[model samples]
Target: MTNFKITLYTDPVCAWCFIGHRTLDQAITLYQRTYPGGRHDMFEFIYHPFYLRNTKPEEGRMTLEDAMLAKNGTEAKVLAIKTKMQRIGTAHGILFNYDSKVGSTKLAHVLIQQAGRHRGAEVQKEMVGAMYSMHFEQGGNINNLDELVAVAVKVGVSEQDAHAWLRDDQVGAEVDELARTAREELGVTSVPTIEIGGLRLEGAEDVGGIMEALVSVKEKEIAVGGAQDPF
Candidate 1:
């Protein structure tokens, strides 16, 4: 019986972060199917907010091609990422349109912090997925307060509370705190950084690789406990 904490660090508007989400979901689903509740208490996955663009919603607006050009990404790189995101998203039944434009995710993360406080952690998770869907799947602007509130309500966060969090600036402080944790505290310089058992799992990893890492961590914990226990 080993306990593992996996922190998923991501931003709402990131393409690869969306891919990482689908990858993690697939890996976890496959792990569950393979284990079938046998390791119920083995691992706990938590979503942590990371803001890729801290700009104002209006200032962050850019088309997909424009963003790629800014990042020095070539057409081949763009197409490769597009294909990868679409493939991974489809595997999880998540629709993602990479051609769309998305703005700053500060408001989205503000809703997430509020969801974690009022509703529950899972609500925050749903909100994250919804933001990703809106940007990557529907090409909707996640920076809009309306979209933020919509996702918040869908995730069980109170609508009135959602409006407060979005329009009234109630959750701005909390969003700042999380952003600080993601940036200064945790030393996260990029989006889509995953941590498992206090170990960082960044970028995209295949299902087999992720599963192997999980199992390896579990085995190490068991071995260490067996060595330390005395009775």
Candidate 2:
């Protein structure tokens, strides 16, 4: 069996990233059903860090709505963007809370890194999904160490370990560097950038688009007899 590595660069607080996460899951389910028998084990998912706001810890937390208004320069524009995001999220079974708090995602990314190191990819994915739900649906402040740790614990991470990892300056710095490398080296200019089988899908593509990309990649890989990378 051939293996396909799927790398997702995302920020926890991004609404589109949340939507993309769910959409990718749906697409993977459909792909597995279409090509069953060991196909499920043929895919490996890895999550990387990307910062949309990159707010400093000292800057503290602000309401997501306030941040958007500041960036978009008008209440109407912010409302329109929120409406669009909410509509898209709802279509993917995600309930977005525009009123949630926004702050530095450094600690959150560190938590995910630690989760992946300790628990593996599936558990790491669970931690990611929980973080998205906390930030988007429950209005939780992921920037807060306690809040992040709480979510981690719920996803099989020990509270002590979560607290230690988040409080580690080295881990936080590593996460920051990774986000920067993703932008500079990986050419990831936006959140929810997905890479699979050498094909890159930018932003939150719909399920159909993602599925098509997957199929195209699979076909190309097969055509090449899995001897070379399929772009």
Candidate 3:
């Protein structure tokens, strides 16, 4: 009956984060099946925003190819990266479409925060997944307000509420501050940084690694009389 919180710092547009998300789910399922009395409800997942690209909404969206070319300095390198991503992503049950748009994830992060505050952690997690799918699968623009609101509606948030929250300067500011804290204070420079029971797994760790980490944390908690402080 012990409760554990798993905090994930991720950006919606990160290809590795998308893979890590699915890998984490597989690891959790493996843990529950392998360990006696391991219930899904015992773990709570909380997602925080970590910006990979800080493009503002006013800057508009850039095609994924253009962004990659700008970063890698050549089309060949970009294609190689995309091909590698597709290979790895296919293994993880994610189909990555590099024809998507890339832009600021601030609104998407704000939506996730609002989901957690209003709907609970599960909904918040669902919203994050939805956002990832929107960008990586559907090739939608994450920075577009209308697209963000549509995602919110799909995740059980009212259209009116989604519009209101995205327009709120205070809420947007809070999301920005959270990203700042994750980067500056927490030393998280990468996306898909997952923390469980004070142990961290950076980047897109494979399913086996994540499962081992989960087991290690659970065993440690049991050994210490379940008194370990939360992360």
Question: If scored against the real structure, what TM-score would every candidate get?
Answer: 0.82, 0.92, 0.94
The lDDT for every candidate, in the order shown, is: 0.71, 0.84, 0.85
lDDT at position 59, candidate 1: 58
Q: Pick the candidate with the highest TM-score.
A: 3
- Write the residue-wise lDDT of candidate 1 on 1-231 in tens digits: 455678888887787787777777777777656743433544555767777765776754676656766676688877776676667767767776555676777777777666767677666667777777777777677777776777777777777888887764646766677778889988998868888776687786777777776666666766777322112
What are the per-residue Cα lDDT tens digits for candidate 3 across 6-49? 99999987889989999999998987777666653378888888
Between candidates 2 and 3, the lDDT winner: 3
lDDT of 2 at 4: 72
Clashing pairs in 1: 97-136
lDDT of 2 by residue, 19-48 (tens): 999999998788777753425336788888
| lDDT, residue 88, candidate 2 | 88
Winning candidate number (lDDT): 3
Residue 207 local lDDT, model 3? 87
Q: Which candidate, 1 or 3, has the higher lDDT? A: 3
Report the C-alpha displacement of residue 111, candidate 3, in angstroms.
Answer: 0.5
Give the higher-TM-score candidate: 1 or 3: 3
